[model samples]
Target chain A: MANVLVNAPKTAKRGSIVEIKALILHPMETGFRPGPNGRIIPRNIIERFTATWNGTEIFDMEMSPAIAANPFVSFFAVASESGTVGLRWTGDEGFVVEERVAIAVE
Target chain B: MIARHFGIGLAIVFIASYALAQGMADKGGTDKRRSGTQDMGGVLQKMQDDDTANPGMLFVQLGGELWGKASGASGKSCADCHGSVASMKGVAARYPAIPKGADAPVDLEGRIDLCRTANQRAGSLTSESRELLALTAYVAHQSRGFPITPPDDPRLAPFRARGEKLWQARQGQLNLSCAICHDDNAGKKLAGVTIPEAHPTGYPIYRLEWQTLGSLKRRLRNCLAGIRAEPYAYDAPEYVMLDLFLMDRARGMMLESPGVRP
Candidate 1:
């Protein structure tokens, strides 16, 4: 299973910015390293990452070999209300993962 | 030149362990603890301090996920029995414990296996397996700030002595011992890399060299290979004893499990 971890605050202040961090576990095999039998490992990496708040797109980006294994990304989102923020990651071999977190604002 | 240096280092370790073993028998690893990271440059140390950059955290995160999922015939997860990893605080500091009435001092991995097999009825994870490292790293991350306290038990007394002996014995084609680089020549440069004091403060760590999280046993095997010696089996008793002695030697030092090391 494509394991992903997301970190966000349980509560936030109205109209303030909150930092969100997310990471996905993967080898991101570069297809450069030679396998034990001298065969080249196939290239596999997350091709795209997207984040949304309340079903509205907040952030999106494309990735490639330059991206390190187990990619981690952090971004700031203005706190407007309480709801769930979700993220989606797409990668080679049809790997897809989603993670969601909830936040509350006073 | 390398062979000669190793011989000198071994001699120093022999004298150091002999003098310190008696005192360490009671004090644990705390007296003058230092981690290998301490000897590293700022960039590496900072990378370890920052969670996002510390690749080891990825494994810990996986472990946290595994803790809650039900598995095996028992249909239970680690969280089911050890609820709230918050309760796991400082638990790693006192481990490789000889479970009451048991003769062997199983490390964190062994303990995890026992729980999986006996309580969860889950399949055992082989040594150095990613899952095992993940779980061990997660459990160890809880004790991050706690000091190591290798148990001083009657059953462990003989094992500790044995560990000390093996640590001092010359081995491999090079006839070098651990003490050579870690003790006698600590703080010196070896082939452009700094020689650390060989303490076990941060373990189950992310090594830049290995590019993955590994146990101290893996490092020990590397050391054996460095000396051109035949390595013991993965589950060898010698490894266990050496682990015990290293923990004791590292007593009192704060743990940095799932640590990042160059």
Candidate 2:
């Protein structure tokens, strides 16, 4: 199961930019590191992250192994109207997590 | 004459280092104590100050969920009895307490497990397990900003003394003691990292080193390993004693649980 945290303003003025932060718990293990048995721990990281507003994609990031564990991403998006903001993450081993939050624009 | 001069130089160096160590130890009561957070750079400190940016909050969130979820045959959750996590305030400050009928001290983690087995009728979570850490962090998080208040019962004196002995005793291949670094060299850089006073103020902390949340025992074990010393088992009483002493030493220091550290 994926443990994720997302923070965004619940309300925003129309056409104003609102900041959003998202965090997801993952080891982000680089392939070069050794395990207890002295064998290399395989690379396992969240490869992609995307955020959409009102069914339109607004923010996207391609992650790498250099990113720290429990990847946290922060960005801003223009609040066009009252709608739902959808966040998605995808990675190695077919890992995927989807979450959404609603915002009211006045 | 050359041999005699070399011997004199060696003696002076040895005495100087020993004096430095002793000077710090002698200044113990008078020396000011600073928290580990003070050693951190501004960026990391800022990271700790801000809740939304701190990664440790993720585990705190997990703990909040576990606090309410029901499990085991009793079908009772922590919320059924404790009401809310808010009720746990100031509780973590007085941990490593000697529970009734028990001769030894049990830290907050042990108390949680005791509650599970006796009250919740559930099995104890394994030491260092994610669920256990989550619950521990959640409980300690409530006590954040409160001062650490080690219990004043007289029976705890011996254990606290034992902990102090361990703190002062040198061990391992390097023959170094906790005081050698934390007390003597505190605030000084070791291998480019500044050493703090080894206070137990912030525990179950989120360390960038481990890239995960960990308890006080984990940090103790790490230091022991760093000194090339054999570490005590996870459930050893010595850890409790050491914890007891650390909390006492850090008395009046604000508890910063679920804290961020380098």
lDDT values of the candidates?
0.84, 0.90
TM-scores, all candidates, are 0.77, 0.86
lDDT of 2 by residue, B1-262 (tens): 9999999999999999987865564345765677788778999888887787788888998999999988667899999989988999998999989888888889999999888888889988998899999999999989987878999989899999999999999999999999999988888889989888899877899999999999999999999999999999998988999999999999877788888999
DockQ of 2: 0.45
Give the winner by lDDT.
2
lDDT of 1 by residue, B81-137 (tens): 899888888777877678756788888888888889888998988988988899888
Question: How many angstroms is residue A67 displaced in model 2 relative to the true structure, after the best TM-score fit?
Answer: 2.0
Q: What is the TM-score of chain A alone in each candidate?
A: 0.92, 0.97
lDDT of 1 at B236: 89
Best by TM-score: 2
Candidate 2 — which pairs collide? none
